[model samples]
Target chain A: MFIDGRALPAGTALEADIAIVGAGAAGITLARALKDSGLSVALIESGGLEWSEEAQDLAAGELGPQTYATPDTVRLRYFGGTTGHWGGWCRELDAIDFEPRDFVPLSGWPLKKAEIDPWYAKAQSVLQLGSPQRYADSEGIAKAAGAALPVARGGDIEPILFEFSPPTRMGEVYRAELEQSAVKTYLNTTLVDLRVGDDTRTVTTLTLARDGGPALAMTARHVVLATGALSNAQMLLAADSQVQGGLGNGADQVGRYFTDHPILIGYAAILALDPSAGGPFAFGDIAADKRRWRLAFQPSEAYRAAQKRLSCLITIEPPGPRFDPAAGAFDRSDAKWFGAPETVNALAAANATGPVRLHVLNAGIETRPNPDSRVTLTGKRDRFGMRRLKVDWRLSDADLEHYLLNLGDFAKALAHSGTALLRIPPDAAARWPEETSWGHHNLGTTRMGDDPRTSVCDRDGRVHGMANLWVAGSSLWTTPGAANPTLTIVALALRLADRLKAEMAA
Target chain B: MSDPVARAWAVTRRTFGATLLGALGLAAVETWPRWAFWRGAASSLDALAGLPQAAALKALGRQAQAAMAIPAGYADTLAARLGDEGYAGAVARDRAEGRLVSIDGWLVPETQALAGLWLASAG
Candidate 1:
């Protein structure tokens, strides 16, 4: 049942077996998983069914010194959450991402990759990604098309694949299923304060507010804060009645170690090849039983471990005529190409007989977690009277070092393979592209770990001191890999659902 | 006939004439393969020589060489001061700074003189 919070009577009190704050991807997934478990669940969302300007204003926050897309603009506050605009690029986090690396400070996950592999397969079905098979392992596509990836297996670089969704918006995709479920969804209901008991170990009740309405209270056996990394940290930091900092923040690590994938664009090369004879780096499409797959490149696990580098993915796109030197000299101010004669000649020759078969490179790099990068509460209040978030997103020098070193390795590999001659400006490592961009992957604010000092939540998504309070979302991620986080977020939510169900059943 | 300046002029002219002839012979020998290749692709040497496309291509080649030109003896100095890696690094830095222009067919600093040397060894 879906209830509009504005229509409720003033000072209403609600009760439930579980109360989930924020009906986004993680919240919705968890709610769906607990649908028929005989547990009365309250799925509370701040926004209405559709987009509203008032609700978006709540996301307005201050940004730190580093440049970023405004928090309000990058994130949406409607029922489905950011999945409403998500590109649906999905891949499982690599095995190494879960391991404790000696070089990376505070880098291991309490849960192993093997523990989550099953959940990933289940999540694949939830996201509608057909199978878990690697795109390169798809038989005959590479051999028949002659578009094999040049990077050798067990080498410095290897082929990786990202399965695209109809880029499923969770609200749209699961609305009908949710409508039939027993869970109660309250829209336009904002979680205002977490009322902790006198002992200060457990949350007794949650205060909620609505636009132009009296406050509401919800008491639940279990409370899951599935609000995104930013909002989750904001709320925890704001609920400072019992604890000076916030609930479950004894060590004051609620919002520290925030991380995002920092993307750099200028480091690129154009590979010239015959139109008839396809290049190894070109995007390959394969139709398997019912799924469509696209191929990409990533460094092998051994390579990343040996080099002590973060995960990175490279994409190949067809070069445009504008990038062709023979077309005419481009203004250095506008063009990304280096305008090398050999490159132009190669492009011209490739286009001489038929279509141009040149490939351009783009990469997405992973950022190592830094403790100083975090989300804090600002003095400014939103319409619902909750303090807004202040994001201090940061990227370390190691992140840039990994990006350049891997890019240099990619160039050397291309040159050695005789696939194409790659010329990298020697000091390309020293200079970064002016416009550094990122995917809207908010992660690591309330990371999961066994140690209470470093992480906000335990491996089961429960807060350390509080037995019933939990967090479910990318916020629980210990480390954000280069791959998109939606599939893993859903997988972790489903895993949490099982634990929650068992606990409720008990 | 007995004047020393006149004798010197005569000797210089003779030596200059011999050097010019020898250089022309070497150039012809070096370019023979390229000429032959073009001849085979085209109908004949005369047919290829007079075509506007041939002239435009030659002009384009010259333009490419000009774009890749560097200072006199700069390559030797660079090669000496910087090893191969350092030289490549310097060249890359220069190109990035817009101090060097890159031609499509040739590497940076590929002058017309280098083209001649490459052609001589092409056979």
Candidate 2:
């Protein structure tokens, strides 16, 4: 049942069979999965049922050389976490995402996509995305949507599908189940410190702080950190008093390899002759079976292998302003014409005799795992005296180059198919990060791997060298694919839930 | 030089000036199979010819020809048999075959880029 952690008297020592920290997508999934396992579970959340300004301010942190959404602004501190504002785009990671690619450094996960396929099926329902089977049946999905997949003839680029959620807000959808379950749910409780035994391997006690209440502690047979990517790293890196670098920092790997899918908003435009309105090839999202669907293009496996390019998901947007190069000399300033919608159609319209303008293209590209792009502690501290995080989210030069190359090839593939003409911005390279935005899907700080020297967690989500302590959420990702991360985050959480149940039973 | 294409080029240079003429004469001699399409007055083709993208468009046309394995004199064959509108049909065909090139960063069929080059030089 829900218990306001703040109402608990000073120095209350709560005990449970399992203590799960930060009740977001990952934590809530675990709590729900283990709700009836007969193990007493303590689910602690920093914010109460609603938004609180004080709680949100605790997430404020500094930025790096590149400009990013400030921590507090990009993330929600209350229940449901960032899902409270997510767009609900969901796609499973490609098989290649789990393999070690020679082109990508620190790439590949210890577990293959197949290892968690069952969990993904379960996660589909948990995410409110119907029928896990539909994701694999491409032709059926296209038939059901009543639209032909773009470039259906086949090329270096092929259409990939994304299933939309009613965007199941976990906090609200499961609030009743949580309330009815046997678990002890602590709201408005922030984990402050982790006390380890003399060996510094097992987390013995967890100290939590409430805004208006005195300090409280929780001891559990097993401890799980499911506080999203940035916060998981922040919490782990902050608990350095007992173990020097942090609880899982024996390899100095905690807070390293942070990543987000870098998106190119309006880098190119497409001109087609009277594109089918609301079709898969047309710009805009489509709906079928009471669910919204979006069709985006990705490089085929052959294309990536042959070109050594990174993965990217390219979507077409409706036509807007016309950047007419036909009217005058195509000057450098005309580069601004990109992202201008009507240019594609205007160009097509200008040709009067045939071919009409189509749409603009937006691409969200993947970045390689670079240790230099990481999260670190700043001297500034929050109200709880915990050092605020400094996010240094970096994208290497090759990352942008690879994305543009993949885009150019995709444009060629479209033309080859007699579908449309794509106009890539001439100055795309010059604009770099200035023209790029992020997925806001923070990932890969406490990555899972077999090597403690390189990763903070093992294949089972257990922090390296630490017993009975586990790290959850996207923070456990070894590589961030171009796919939006929530589905995978939930899938992995379910997988971990099964493992945790077995461990407790043993 | 007495060919109608030469006559059209004369009009084009006079209309748009010589500096922007670029390699129009050389491009025409090497790539244009038949210059009959230049029989009209200096049209919108003249404007495109004067743009900075004209050079790259010519180069892309040549690259497209090589990539698509189109005969060197195929342009003349199409123009001779199909007339001025033949290039547009060829662009559609080239697009269907996936024979494309990037000119000024705009992805266009190889035949389209070649036609742009031909028009720039044909006039």
Candidate 3:
């Protein structure tokens, strides 16, 4: 049943066995998993089934140093969460990402990749992506495309694969399923505060409100915080009536170690292959099994281990219409070749005939978790009187060093193979790009770990020292990997659901 | 004749001469492209011997004319050399100037060089 919080009377109190805040990808996946499990579930969302400006303003926050998408614009406040605009690129984190590395500070996950492989399979189905076997069998793509990825193994670089989704929007994809289930969804209800007991360990009541409506309260045996990375920390920091700093923030680790994948245009090169030979290098056709895949390049695990560098993935893009001379109107006589006119003329003549294929290189670099890069509370409050967030996202010199070194290695590998000649201006490698871009993947604010002193939540996604409070989102990530986080986010949510089910049965 | 001052002066002069020759040798290696430009251009035609297409030779000629700032008739001589045994030498000149590079049997201009040509053609 869908309940409009606007229609509720003042002081209305709802009861359920499980009360989940934020009806996004994680919330919806958990609700679906708990359906018909003999437990009553209340899934609450801040917005209606669609977009609302008033609801989005609740996410407004200050960007401290870097230029980043505002919290309000980077994420959607609707039922589906940020998946509403996601590109649906999905890849599982490599085993190396979960291991404790000597070079990477604050790296390592409490759980191994094997522990979550089963949930990843289930997540594949929920995402409407094809079978996991398809990703395991790369030869299928080579057979279907009739050409292999021009990359070879046993070198400094290796090819990695990514699968695309119909870019599944959970609200649209699972709306009917949610309506048919026993989970009761309350739309336009915002989580205002969490009333904890005197011990500061157990949450007793949750205060909720809607625009132009009376405030309501909810009581539950178990509460799950599925709000995204930014809001999850914001909610925890704001719910500080019982604790001095915030609930589950005794170690001051609640909002620290914030991270995002820093992206930039790495290099440019021409594939020595003829235009006809470019077909195999392009995004592979959706196989007969309805799975579309693309290949990217990354340094091998051995190389990374030897170099002690963070993981990064290089994406190749074909030259678009921007390369067409007819489309571009520019003066050649005034063209400066950096003192190489013969080379310039030869390049123009080659481009006019379109004999060789051009490729642009872009990469996503993993920024190490830093205690200084964090989210803290601002003096100003939101519509519900909760303190707003102030985000200080930063990147270290190590991050820049890892990106440039790996790119240099990749360029050399291409040149050595006689496949292409890579060109990156010397200055570009000396410093980070002036304007850094990100995929809006917020992570690590409420990271998980075995030790309560280092992480906000335990390995099972439970808040430290709290029996019934848990977090479910990318916020629970121990370390952000090079791959997109949606697949892992959904997988972790499903794993949390199973734990909740087993606990309830016990 | 056995004075220590005269003996020291002779040793110093020999050491200085050897150091100067070593420095010159290193400089030549570093600045080979600039110093060898004429020799490399004269031999550029050798680099194109492997190319099978006459049109490819003509294209190289045109690029050479524009790059060398020579008249149209001079371009024909460069183009003929491009199709002869000296094609490799001609290509060496272009490569030294950052004009041409070979990839998978096809000789093409570097991306920067192409951009320059495109701009010139647009004008």
Model 3 lDDT tens row, B11-119: 9999999999999997885555323332433343332222322222343344543544433344355544343424334444454554544322223544322322233
| Candidate 2 TM-score, C-alpha based | 0.83
lDDT of 2 at A185: 88
Clashing pairs in 1: A341-B103, A341-B104, A342-B104
Rank order (by DockQ, best first) = 2, 3, 1
**TM-score of each model, paired residue for residue:** 0.79, 0.83, 0.80
* TM-score for chain A in each prediction: 0.93, 0.93, 0.94
Question: Per-residue alpha-carbon lDDT of model 1 for B3-29, expressed as tens digits?
Answer: 898999999999999999999987885
**Residue B77: error of model 3 in Å?**
22
Candidate lDDT scores, in order, read 0.72, 0.77, 0.74
Q: Candidate 1, residue A301: CA error in Å?
A: 0.3
Best candidate, TM-score-wise?
2
Give the per-residue lDDT of model 1 (tens digit) for A134-166.
544623445545566565554687666777877
Cα lDDT, model 3, residue A367: 78
Clash counts for all predictions: 3, 13, 23
Q: What would you estimate as the lDDT of candidate 1?
A: 0.72
Residue lDDT tens for model 2, A53-171:
98898888988988778888878877777777888888899888888889888899999989989999999989999876665455566777787665763468877778899898888
